[model samples]
Target: MAYGEALALQRDLAQRRIDRSLDHDLLLLVEHPPVVTLGRGSHAEHLVAPKEFLAAKGVELFEVERGGDVTCHGPGQLVGYPIYDLTQHRRDLHWFLRALEECLIAALRDFGVAGERRDGYTGVWTGGRKIASIGIHVKQWVTWHGFALNVMTDLSLFDLIVPCGIPDVAMTSIQKELGERSPRDLWGRALDAVVLAFCEVFRQQAQMVELEAVRSGA
Candidate 1:
C-alpha cells in the first residue's frame, strides 16, 4: 500500500474507534513500495538524500505525523499500524511501546531470531542490529502509526537517511539473520507469528478480517 493510503486508512479507523463506530482494535499490515517518511521529530539533516536523487530513484518522500525521525520503508518489509485504543489496554505510552516491542520480539523468536531491546533505544534489536523500527501517535487514547519489521527489506535504502536519527545504526532482516535466501516463504509465517504475538500480548482472540471489512466499517 502507498503511505498516503495507509495514513488515510489509519485516520479513518482511528476516528471510527474514537466515535464508537468500530468496536475492536485493528492491526493493519502492509508492504510499501520504496519510500521515505519523516515524522514529527525528523530532522532535515537526517534525510541526507537530495530531492533530485530521490526523484531520480523513484522513491517517494512524505512527511508524516508519527513520532520519530526519518525512516525508510520498502517492499519485503512488514509494516504494522495498530489502531489500538490505549483505554482498553494501558493508558501509558511507554507501556504501549514496550508491548509493541514484545510482540515483535515474540514473533521473531518464532523464526529463531533472538530479538532484544537495547537500553535507551525505543526499538527492537538483535545482536546490536536493529530488526524493527517503531513510532506511534495517539489521540484520545487511540493509537496509530506503529512499527516496521525488516523481513527482507533492502537495507541499502536506509542509507538515504539516518534511520530513526540514530547514527552508525545497522539494520538487519530475518533473511540476513538466517543467512539464507528464500522462495518468499518466511514472510507468510512471519506475518502469522506477528498476528499471533499481538493476540497473545494483548490477550485478544483476533480474527483476520479483510481490508474490505475494515473499509466498510464492519
Candidate 2:
C-alpha cells in the first residue's frame, strides 16, 4: 500500500480500537513505493537531496507525526504498522519500544541473522549497521507507525537522507548480509517468524484475518 493509504487505515483502526469497536491488535505488513518520511523531530537538513531530485526520482516526501528522524521506505522493505492497545499491557512507552526491538531481534534470529540492540539507540542493529528502523506514535495509549526492516531494499535510496538523524551510519539488509538469497524466497517465513515473535513478546493470540473482514468488522 502507499504510505498515505496505510496512514489513513492506521488512523481508522486506531480510532476503532479506542472506541472499543476493534477487539484485537493488528499487525499490518506492507511495501511502499519509494518515499522519504520526516518525523516530528526531524530537521530539514537531514534530507540530503533537494525536492526536485526527489521528484525526478519518483520518491515522495512526507512529514509525519511519528517519533524519530528522517528515513526512507521503498520496495523490498518490510514495514510493519502495529495498531496495538497498550491499555491491555503496561502503559509504559519505553517498555513498549524495547519490546518491539526484542520482537524484531527474535525474528531476525530465526533467519540466522544476529540482530542486536545498541545501548542508547532505539533500533535493532548488527555489526554497527542498523538492520531495522522503528518510529511510532501512540494515541490514547494505542500505538501505530511501527518498524521498517530492511529485507531486499535498495540501500542506495538511504543515501538521500541521514537515516534516523544519524550521519555516517550504514544501513544493512538481510539480502546484503546473506548473498544468494532472495527476499521473496523468505518473505513468508519471515512474516511468520515476526508474527510468532510478536505474539510471544506481547502475550497475545494472533489471528489471521483478511483485510476485508476487518474493514467490514466481521
Candidate 3:
C-alpha cells in the first residue's frame, strides 16, 4: 500500500484506541513503499522539485501530519508500523522515540553498520549519511506511524527533498554502506533485532502476534 494509505490506517487505529474499540494487545508490521512523504509542519521549500517533475517520475508527494520534516520510502526499505497501545505501556513520546531509535541501532549493528542518533536529531545515522528515518503521528497517547530503515532503498529519490530540513545531509542504504546485497536471511536478522530492541527498551518480553489479530478489532 501507499504511504498515504498507511498513514490513514494509523489514524484509524488511533481513533479506535481513543474510543476504546480496539482489541488485542498490540501489533506491528514491517513493510516497504514506493514513494516519499513530508510532514505537514515541514516547509514546502525543502522539496526541491516541481510538482510536475515528481508526477512525471511516478513518485507521489504528500504532506502528512506527522512530526519531522521530509523523508523518502521505497522498495527494499524496511518500514515499521507498530500499532501499539501506548496507554498500556508509557504515553511518553520521548520514550517511544528512543525505543524506536534503539531498534534501528540494534538492527544496523547486526548488519555491521553502526546506527546512532545524533544529538538533537531524531533518526538513525551511520557515518554521515542517514540510513533510517523516524517520524510519527500520535493521537490520545497512542502511536501508529513509525520508522523506516534504508535496508536497500533507492537513495536517488531523497535528493528531491532536503531531508529533515538539513542541508547536505547525506542518505545511505545498507547495500551501499555494507557493500553487499542483503543476505538471504537478512530480514530475519533485522526482525530479530527489532524485537530484541523493543524488549530491551520497554523492559518487557514481547510476543509476535499476527496482523489479523490487530485487524479483527484492534
Residue 193 displacement (Å), model 3: 2.4
Residues forming the 10-long window of minimal summed lDDT in candidate 2: 180-189
Measure candidate 1: CA RMSD.
1.2
Model 3, 49-77: lDDT tens digits are 88788888888877777899877777877
Question: What tens-digit string does per-residue lDDT give for candidate 1 at 58-166?
Answer: 9998898889899989998999999999999999999999999999999999988999999888999999999999999999999999999999888998999999999
Give candidate 2 misplaced runs (Cα > 4 Å): 181-184
Cα error of candidate 1 at position 214, Å: 1.0
> Which residue pairs does candidate 1 place in steric collision?
none
What's model 3's overall lDDT? 0.77
How does candidate 3 fare on TM-score?
0.88
Q: Estimate each model's TM-score.
A: 0.97, 0.96, 0.88
